[model samples]
Target: MENKTRPEGFEQIFFADGNNLAKAHPVKQDIAKLKIALRQLHHNADLLIDAFIQRCESENVPVDCHMGCQWCCNQAVFASTHEMVVLVDYLERRFSPEVIAEVKEKARLKEEKLTELSPKEVLNTSLPCPLLRKGTCMVYPVRPMGCRIYLSSSEKSCHAKYDNPEDPTVIPKLFDFTLKAGRQLNEGFAASMRDEGLDMKEHRIEHILLKLLESPDKKNEWLQGATIHDNFPFDEV
Candidate 1:
């Protein structure tokens, strides 16, 4: 397949991140080693995002997203299996068993509701993210690329879309260049994992997290380059 043209100044970032992640791939079946690689990936991505936001500010393209902005949190979130593993690890280490159980139940309910909807319906539906609690992401620092890249230029536009989900005309004014850069960074890392013969399929955050949290062994299987979950619906990019 022909490669898509990357945004200006992002091609080098993509190659550098991809090469670093590919080289960081653990030679053995060790989850700690894998987490280290994932942490590096997140750190690099965050730096790029921070630079992008700075550029946007200098160019007068303001980003209106702020703390307590939960409008965007009421939408579907898709993440890679690798991200889910890191999230699971974080939850287990930082949260209590009861909190984890609550998250699982929330994810379970959302998954159940989502299973009955078509892809288009799912997109138009506004369901609160399982990770969102009290108007903040429970795992903000380690949030997936999809969540990190979603920056709106106007809070009003975001509110319109959130309040009028069925109205196709009500669209959020998101920063296109930021989105492209973020997605390419993620794709570059995914490409590296693909080269290592690992499964890089993306799924709804709640769906995949529920599966991994319920069956902890699946996380190890995935780290060892095993394709385990095949029945879950693929999150539309």
Candidate 2:
């Protein structure tokens, strides 16, 4: 997918009125539409990655990441609430109550553990994703854009950074095309919400997860921009 054109009315969606934020109360159907649009954007990303992968293979470049290889999950998985809604909605339908409880507990613990660290510090730390089990992501269907674009050609480089993450230089080879597209769509959603006066800010997925887990009603408050993660311990969003 070369992405020569935006999805239909993407311009209208993105360029909606920012001053009219009071109008951004996205209903269930609107949110569903947003999720579908995101999925479409991700599909375009997949096409780009597939083509990129083929070219890399022609050049003898190997992407070491495969099923059951999830060392990257140990690092931070930050995302906008817009992106994360996909994960949470999917989990609610497919995950059992037991799994939901476990995930909540995990998010709470992670929130508590990382409360003292700044966002930058937290990024350098290795904390297993609460949704990763054994070596698989339970919510892979809705993994964030960051996860989608990150691919390692060398496991040694991944493990080295995993072991000593403070170095910051040891990172995987990420595709710019996918990252750019994902951000365009994700931030576009933010702008759409902001146009309606919604909370257009992004946050670490874990922090928002903790809030939603504690109170299901928080989602409405968050979308309305009436409450930030004031209850959240991390000062750095």
Candidate 3:
């Protein structure tokens, strides 16, 4: 996840002059309420973020990120067990069998390659995401929380950091409160799932995909508290 600080006057940045605040309503009580709430919260936050960015651009502080920019796609990305449901569901319903086969191999190869690298080497590793097709996210709508909030105002900085992953100074601006709120909402989702006896541990993209590819029922089993697999999702690298 993106580690960033709220810029000075953070509240103002998010809710500047003339920006109307959003109100929330209670959810209908149901077994899948948490998942529903998670989607609602994410959707609402996405709106605020989109509005905020629009206003920022009006003031000449436009974000350099545009569609089809895949500089950040070539790196390590993670998703929680809670978010994996969204991913797996999308793949099963939307992608064809041939597409699924190709992505499974791509994800498995990434996992194997990263496992052999040292910590430093892994940090500098660059691999196209299995879901990335020609520089666009195939599952953009159902992308994880981490992917949703990873915004930047500088494309040059993105390139710099992606090229020299070891550099501390070459960085991009990320909204701290945006990331924090999204994570807290996700935490609630995970907590709810755990209460329902689900495995809510975070996992790397490839590891989770490989397991799901092997067994289609893994999600259903894990949701019911089944210890079907080992605890470690990412290797000890």
Candidate 4:
């Protein structure tokens, strides 16, 4: 479906922002600059999403998502390599060593479990994200676009889906326009990275995070045009 509620000229905005991001990091060594550029893109996307939420409220359209509402967390999360790098950087700077170690263990276990499941089984299973803690997301601020854009219009519907994930009859009422716009913007950013000769493949969050945490230098290697996590199984969200 198309983004009916997207702001006018959003396509142009996406193109320009993507090109600017590519320009911001001219060389492979500009990893820091790339992070900054990605952050700016995220910031801008948040503002746009907030505005859309407000518009929905003004129109009497209920948005059931809020802090501490995490029924949707018990599902697969796919993210780009760049997003994983930013998250790894955040974990290193903000979390204590103990917490990082715990996170790594959680990710490792989750990855192992996922590897044993078939793609269909993985989709039907309910597995909490490693970053989730006490009914909240530990990395909400720097979460991937996939997590950022998933919004439900009914809390009860979310609960129904969460409780009966394998029930094809149950479905959450989501904000389609928000998802579409957010995904388009993320694709624009990813396209920019690809244009810069970087591998912009998306992977299952747990698998990619485990690899990145185990070998911190993999981030630099990836930045230098080397591919990592190529063997990890992934499914598009």
Candidate 5:
């Protein structure tokens, strides 16, 4: 059985934006109901993460991961637009205006470094996440699923170089476990539980995060507890 932590103020990011949406016309009822699916997804994602940790332990992989380690946080990890919408809404509600302004400024700078064609390069450029403040992820509990899964591994995978045959190799085997298990479990979950009919590729994570930052509707509704829903039912993106 999944051991779900009782959600707190910081944990609110995991849930749907219901306060404002409750007022929407009845047409959005199905969308509101999507919270249930998202919750299930989170539960499944948690299981995958547990499996990753267990794999690392079984293999005796040395992981140097810890809190305040923001290296992975810099990269542009992929996530569904649905996830981003939920994340942005939660941040809006939880963060103060000053915090939001600071985050936007950080994102603005990060955005300047990002090229549309090279998302990974931009994300992996060693710059901490725009929302990272004083060595802590400001969005901690509500952070993306990728961010959560990545914590179970060591930092070596982030620095490994399969391209350099001459380089002496001592990197931990954590990435291998995450890659294999992620493919087997996480991918399966996304395929089976995702909302049906949505164009999965239409929203890349970087685009969604950037859009969420800029969208006042999303920002406000987030503060007021609202998120975008597809007019037509769409699969999880």
Candidate 6:
């Protein structure tokens, strides 16, 4: 995907007002389009993943995912409503009510445990995901797309590579195409929210999670603007 063409929707929001758009760094309309196109390129990532796996097998690249080594799961992950809806549905169908209650309680407890840290610190902490069961992801089959493409090709430190002393995992290969796809998905969702006039500026993981828990139907609401708002259409999880 090139900058010459982008999703029509992308331009609508990224260039909403002349003044607001001008105040920021000057990005030509075409360059801005590239951002959207870059995102759309990952829309069919399932196909890409299958291809990636085939390539990996042929090239002898080892993927380091296994039982009890879920470094990614031990973090405060966030998702768009689409991702949460998928996970919530899977949980409802596969787990019992007790399990669901347990997950929610754990989520609340984890929030308190990490409350004092900055949002980035909270997000970066290596605590077990609220849905982890005995060190395993309860919703592994339906886990978010972000979890699927983070293939660690080595045991070396990714953090150390960047000179970060606290880094625990090394991502020798992150499948950038997948990340591009997610960016597009999020941008598109944010664009849709803008079209519907929603605000999501201050929303963090907690805000989104609370909204999901309060009303699954709330997902239908428009999540727009540079901020997150509590209006528009949604479905209950």
* lDDT per model vs. reference: 0.78, 0.65, 0.65, 0.79, 0.49, 0.49
The C-alpha RMSD in Å for every predicted model, in order, reads 3.0, 6.5, 6.1, 4.1, 10.3, 10.9
Alpha-carbon shift of residue 133 in model 1 (angstroms): 1.4
- Give the C-alpha miss distance for residue 96 in model 1, angstroms: 1.0
Tell me each candidate's TM-score.
Answer: 0.88, 0.77, 0.77, 0.89, 0.61, 0.59
Overlapping backbone residue pairs in candidate 5 total: 7
State the weakest 10-residue window (summed lDDT) of model 4: 1-10
lDDT of 2: 0.65
Enumerate clash totals for all models, in the order shown: 0, 3, 0, 0, 7, 24
Task: Mark the regions of model 4 whose C-alpha exceeds 4 Å error after superposition.
Answer: 1-16, 24-27, 231-237
Relative to the unseen true structure, what is the C-alpha lDDT of residue 33 in candidate 2, on a scale of 0 to 100? 60
Q: Answer with 1 or 4, whichever has the higher lDDT.
A: 4
Alpha carbon lDDT at 11, candidate 3: 44
For model 1, what is the C-alpha lDDT against the true structure? 0.78
Report the number of the highest-lDDT candidate.
4
lDDT of 6 by residue, 97-206 (tens): 78878877777777677666665565446666777788788877656545665655543433333343235453334556545544454444444433334333322333
Cα lDDT of model 3 by residue, 105-193, tens digit: 99889989977877557657778788898778888877887787777778887788888776767666665655655555555444445
With a 3 Å backbone cut-off (N, CA, C), the pairs that clash in candidate 3 are none
- Tell me which residue pairs clash in candidate 5: 75-123, 195-235, 195-236, 196-235, 197-235, 198-234, 198-235
Better of 1 and 5 by TM-score: 1
Give the backbone clash total of model 1. 0
Which candidate order results from sorting by TM-score in descending order? Answer: 4, 1, 3, 2, 5, 6
Cα lDDT of candidate 3 equals: 0.65
Mark the regions of model 5 whose C-alpha exceeds 4 Å error after superposition: 1-32, 116-120, 151-153, 156-173, 183-195, 202-206, 218-237
For residue 43, model 5's alpha carbon misses the true position, in angstroms, by 2.3
